[model samples]
Target: MRFDILTVLPGLLESPFAHSILHRAQKKGLTEIHVHNLRDYSSNKHKSVDDYPYGGGSGMVMMIEPFAVCIEKLKAEREYDEIIFMTPDGVTLNQGLANQLSSVKNIMILCGHYKGIDQRVRDLYVTREMSIGDYVLSGGELPAAILVDAIVRLIPGVLSDETSALSDSFQDDMLDAPVYTRPADWKGHKVPDILLSGNTPEIEKWRFEQAMERTKARRPDLLE
Candidate 1:
């Protein structure tokens, strides 16, 4: 899979894709992430990509031309499965959505800034819109990083044990059961007796029951 992120602050995203699982994914050829500077597509001599919103607004709106040029150029290279604009008003992103996107071949993420992008840009180019949550952020750079991580990690071979992503919390509409590491006994606590038991079926049943209990106590909404 490949992702092209259009942002005015490309430097802000440097560290996110440079380390951890994302970096490993890139190295292993499981995925490719490229951050494109919106300024590079600006028509103005000063490379301006944002301007005051017409009719009155508190902050500047990202202009349409830069986004259009960048997206069009990228589209020429390869067909994009989705052109997603990151905004607070967009559909709240979830694990299911990440799983869906993991199957796509190409994606273009637009990181909105200031008062957000010109509406025409969204209407003309964006195929989907997503938000990490209901809250707002200073810019979409961080959210884009988060979205990329969520989707990329679900791709086959991205994780050493591919099954690891399948068992992640939310994959089954229930929270993951509690887990314990080595030194089975720690302080006054101990690993679950069932987990230590060699009976696979019994251990699996215990894990499911624990997951259900925790989900009911925490995110009961998932059960519904």
Candidate 2:
């Protein structure tokens, strides 16, 4: 998969993909992540990409010119499966969405700053809009990075254990069963006998029950 992220604060996104799964995914040829500075597409003499709202809003609105040129230039190079704008009002992102996007060949993400991007740009170009959560943030760079991470890790060969993402929380609409490692008997606490017994069927059943209980206690909404 390929992802092109457009942001005014490209610096904010530098660190998120530089470590861990995402970095390794790129190195292994499983995915490509490109960050474009929107200011580079600015038409302003000072290279400003925002302006006072036409209706006189308190904060500056991102001008459409920069986004227009950027999107057009990208489309000319290759087709995009989705052009996603991260915003508070868009559909909230979840594991299902990430899983769906993992199949796409290419995507474009635009990060909004200041008040937000001009509505015209969204109407003209964006195929989808996504929100990380209900709450608002100062900018969309973080959300863009998060969305990419979520999708990238699910791609085959991105993780050392391919099944790891399949069992991630929310992939099954249930939380994960508690896990224990070496020193399971720390402080007199012992590993569950079923796990130690090497009874795969019984152990799987126990994990499912534990996951169901945890989900009911913490996030019953997922079950509904």
Candidate 3:
């Protein structure tokens, strides 16, 4: 999969793709992530991409011209499956959405900034709008990084153990079961007996029960 992200503050997103799973995914040819500076598309002498709102809002609104031009330039190069705008009012992102996007061949994500892009830009260019959560942030650059990470890790071969992504929390609308590693009996805390029994069916059943219980206690919304 290939992801093209547009942001006014591209420097803020540099560290996210430079290490860990995302970095490895790019190296292995499983995924490609490109960050484009929105300012580059500005036509003005000062390269201004935002302006005072026509109705006199407190914060400046991103201009439509740069976004339109940037998106058009990208579309001219190759077709994108989805053009997503990251904003607080968009649909909240979840594991299921990430899973769906992992199969997409190419996508474009626009990072909303200041008061957000002009509404006309969204109506004309964006196919989907996504929010990381219910709360708002200073800008959408962080959310774009989050959305990209969520999608890229689910791509086949991006993870060393492909099944690990499959079993991640929310994949089945259930939280992951508690896990333990070496030094099973650490400071008097022993590993569960069923895990050590090597009984596959029993172990699976236990895990499911644990997940259900954990979900009920912490996030009953998923169970419903």
**Worst lDDT 10-window in candidate 2:** 178-187
Clashing residue pairs in candidate 3 (N, C-alpha, C atoms within 3 angstroms): none
Q: Candidate 2, which segments miss by more than 4 Å at Cα?
A: none
Global Cα lDDT for candidate 1: 0.96
> Candidate 2: TM-score?
0.97
Q: What is the clash tally of candidate 1? A: 0
Estimated TM-score per prediction?
Answer: 0.97, 0.97, 0.97
Q: Candidate 1 on 93-200: residue-level lDDT in tens?
A: 999999999999999999999998999998999999999998999999999999999999999999999999999999999999998889989897889888888999
lDDT, candidate 3, 15-61, per-residue tens: 99999999999999999899999999999999999999997869999
Say which candidate scores most in lDDT: 1
Model 2 residue 70 lDDT score? 93
Task: List model 2 lDDT by residue over 174-200, tens digit each.
Answer: 999998788868899898878887889
lDDT of 2 at 192: 86
Worst 10 residues of 1 by lDDT: 188-197
lDDT, model 2, position 163: 90
